[model samples]
Target chain A: MSKNSMKESYKIKDNYNTSIKIKSLVITLICLILTIICLLPIYLLVINATRNTSDILNGATLIPGNETLNNYKNLMALDGFNALTGFKNSFIISGSAALLSVFISALTAYALVVYDFKLRGPAFTFILAVLMIPTQVSAIGFVQFMIKIGFFNTYVPLIVPAMAAPSTVFFIRQFMKSSFPLDIVEAARIDGSSEFRTFLTIGIPLLKPAMSVQLIFAFIANWNNFFTPSLIITRTEKYTLPMMINTLSSDRYTDYGMVYMGIALSIVPLIVVYFILSKYIIEGVALGGVKE
Target chain B: MASNAQRRIKHVSYAKYGYFFIIPFFLVYFIFSFYPLVNTMRYSVEKNLSKEATIYDGEFVGLDNYKHILTSPDKNAEDYYVHAGMREGFLRALSNTFKIWVMNFFPQMILSMILAVWFTDAKLKIPAKGFFKVVMYMPNIITAASVAVLALKMFSNDSFSIVNNTLLNWGLIDEPIQFLADMKLKRTIIAGIQIWMWFGNTMILLMSGIAGINPSLFEAANIDGANSRQVFFRVTVPLLRPILLFTLVTSLIGGMQMFDIPYLFNPGTNRSPGTQTIAAFIYQIYMESRIKNTGHSGAASVVLFIITAALGSIVFYINRDKDEIAAKKQLKKLRKQAAKKAHGGLGL
Candidate 1:
């Protein structure tokens, strides 16, 4: 009876080991497949960006070609190919929007977290409710409002709307709740620091991580914003990177090579920004997930 | 007594300071956002078109515009004029939006969850996982219009498109597919592009959720002779429900507001009637009113706002109820387990 039991146990153990190996192999294969699928479109973008219109239409090669520089030159020579102006517009809009949003959101979060107020619950709930409303729902009204207020075709509409982002406020609030210690606030208060001063000097400094995340989020949102600009900005010279890229298709020449080049050029800044701030972006997204 | 008055003054000053700190955001919000929202709601009730129009000058439309847009058969036709009730174009756009939402949002969520689970599995040590993540997420950082443009090129019906070429080379089809031109194919391709752009964000969230799960729980399940599938279903899924729900709700809201993809895909030249979303439809009405010299675009905006708000609230409420039920079940389970342990000689 003992020998029979030992043999059965050995058989069971063997089955478990085999299954584990199989599961690992299966998962590994799946990951490989997904990674390839995810990377292919980007690879195609790069390849197409390098080739001339004819080569792009004829061949699909994985390697870098000699026509890359020529294609880029042709792209830059196109009408409305003001790379400098596009970059300037994008940077100004995205940077200003990010700074303003982070500041406002952080201050609001600070007040909600450190202060005792009668309307705190209602105020926070209001912000949360705003997060649920789609921005497009108000797109029409916002455009009309912009035109009425004489802010049409200007950066004010873009930068100002971002300041009241409920998502940023919510994120900053969560960060303050979890990461900011009450003892520090109390100590600051005991040291005769006013609430505003404490928030500005102490709270804001401590919120660097959250602020960084908010900056990236706000920047990305503003930078990628095409719908609002499309609706409001009709002037060719006022076009941001996205709006400029959209205008590429409007050209009668229809240079596929130049179009791809423009697409590639438009994405390069974001890729650079991502590489620099990826750590914060990942953490912000993770934290944002935790709250919802 | 003097010090007591000073303390009261100080308290009042602090309250004022709080208000001062919040004032900047309020100012911007009120001017750029809140006022627009209020104006939208107000405009929904009134009919005002001219520069001389006033709240009192405008006749109260009541809910007539909403009724006409929602219930009128004439409004539901594709080629119907924007001013002649609800147009058929608007209905087609609404349906396209919902189709894109279902096709893109759910698959993106599910695939993200699957990828997250696979990445977090202990047995699979995928090399360069971080690199792949960065690559996948790069598209997310790019402007949506640019991505749409790239998608346009890649899915072009021309001989250059990889999709068409591959299919033809593989003998899968005798002719190239017009991915963006045909209605069904257009929606699918657009949804595919959107999913490609967004899945990275979902994957990142799901990965974090999966990472938060305690390893010992899986170990305990393994000790009980549970298979991988069972462990995922019984342990991982229940714990990850909140994150999944969050993804679903956010995606649904985002999906409903989708405009850039369809807009960029169709552009102004193609004017593919079938590719218009409700947002695009609203934009079209606005354009027509501006160009054709009419004021009915305001009416269309009112209708669009109502549809978006109604749909958004319904989804939000449903998800909230589901979340509350799940929370209650978790609480009940904890309580029963506690009671059982209390009645026994030792804790489980």
Candidate 2:
């Protein structure tokens, strides 16, 4: 109620505001430094992709160079590093695998959610059990089985297993548990729709958001998958993008510029996709992180 | 109308349809996953190996392969590398895997925790938070194989590599360091790369975990005159336990399966003993080594499977809905009580 008391209160408030301001400024600077640390490697790769081999060998530089066309030409001329073929093979495998995984996982999740069958609980338990088993455990046997069955060097081994992605089904089922309305399925059935037809017509559309998120994730995972494909496909011409990049480790490929160009090409598409759909991908990860 | 529809839906037996819908998944899984798992176990016990470039499927040898890879020889044995059993190599690989995982996981946890707390703090006036997150997560989405190759190029043991060149230019060292040849430096770089690629992902997951905590709790802390440090240790950490447990279990399982980075970091015959993970060990015996030994690979895989199963069950148990379990227990108790009362009345 007095002028002196008011002045004291104002001084205290000013001190608090300045302290908060200092804290924010310090945190922001830390974040900026972290951002640079994350991007610097990829940035160097891109910049070196444009430089000549001698320049890259001499040292790392921040500026772009004039040898972009030369690097591309050298990469094309290199052996066991066909970028086009690698791209084609990777695209076919990843695209088909993603489509199969999302569709089948959605169907499986739908069954687990929409039905009240006797084996429903048991079926889910089986999936959970399967989820616990890592693929590396069975990898040696898988390769041998495929070899005996004459499926080695074929895309079947890579693509078919996508249909049984327990983790994807589990994630989608989690998404549906909170959002899917059972009444819609009943309404569709009463309107003379067959059960499968109802699922195809109504259930799938309702699950688009979850399906899309899983689709992107599945595609990226399949694309980046190296171990299984490396085990299956041993032929040089049939190599995936990762296999191609891995071959660059041999002592023969001493051309640093060309190697940088190859690595850059492999990662550029994912970066482009990330820049565009990052909001969904980041949110999807957050959604998947929290257990029901 | 709703009642009629409900009645019709109840009368219809969609059970078989559910069976039909899920059959494809189970079928694929059994053929691709379950059968192979069984086959791997069989191989572990069988004499399926290549000797002198000839493949042989000899009689079943129970536990021989496991002992061969797991049992150690005499303590005073000479020429350790020439020993019949590979227990030393296998153990070394397992330890290396653990070392690399621990080296990366602790630093990653600390950095991610700080970033997550800062980003999620409502009081902090952080700018461009979204941009920062996108950039940070960019490394995780890139092909790890490519990232490894990029790392090799950067830290190669020659003067021409990026890292060596930069250090030489900055006058930090008189000569280029042999990064991949030396065990310790190689492990450190591999661990550093692991930290770089994963900290962003861990940060995001932790941020979501922190966000799920009730804001009212923080406000209550503030009203009680608790500082940020006290609030973090008391309010936030306690509430974030479940998610933290989930992260730990998943990270452990993932660490057990770490293959691409360590395997690709030092390719060919020069792979240091310091960085050979379990997965790499399996791959080498079965695929890369001169003598292909499926039995040893299969036996090692069985060990990995057991570890993963144990870890996975912990997650499963923790994730089981507590409320549902309690509700089920209550229902069973009530049913028992009613049954007892009915029997007593009948006797009277």
For lDDT, the strongest prediction is 2
- Over the stretch B92-135, how does candidate 1's per-residue lDDT look in tens digits? 77788889889998788888878788778776656677766776
Give a tens-digit lDDT track for model 2, residues A1-292: 8999999999999998898889999999999999999989999999999999889988999999999999999999986679889999999999999999889999999999998788987788777766757778899888888887888899999999877998888888888888999999877877889888998999999999999988988988899989899999988888899999898876677787888999999998889998999998898887853221
Interface RMSD of each: 3.8, 2.4
Candidate 1 residue lDDT tens string, A38-157:
667767777777878777666566876667788788877877666667878988998999898899989988887776666665666666656567666666567777777778889888
Candidate 1 — what's its lDDT?
Answer: 0.73
Q: What lDDT is obtained when candidate 2 is compared to the true structure?
A: 0.86
What tens digits encode model 2's per-residue C-alpha lDDT throughout B90-170?
898899999999998999999999999999998889999999999888888889899998998889889999889999999
Interface DockQ per candidate: 0.43, 0.64
TM-score for each candidate, following the candidate numbering: 0.86, 0.95
Off by over 4 Å in 2: A289-292, B1-7, B51-56, B74-85, B267-269, B322-324, B345-348
User: How does candidate 2 fare on TM-score?
Assistant: 0.95
Consecutive 10-residue window with the lowest summed lDDT within model 1 chain B: B288-297
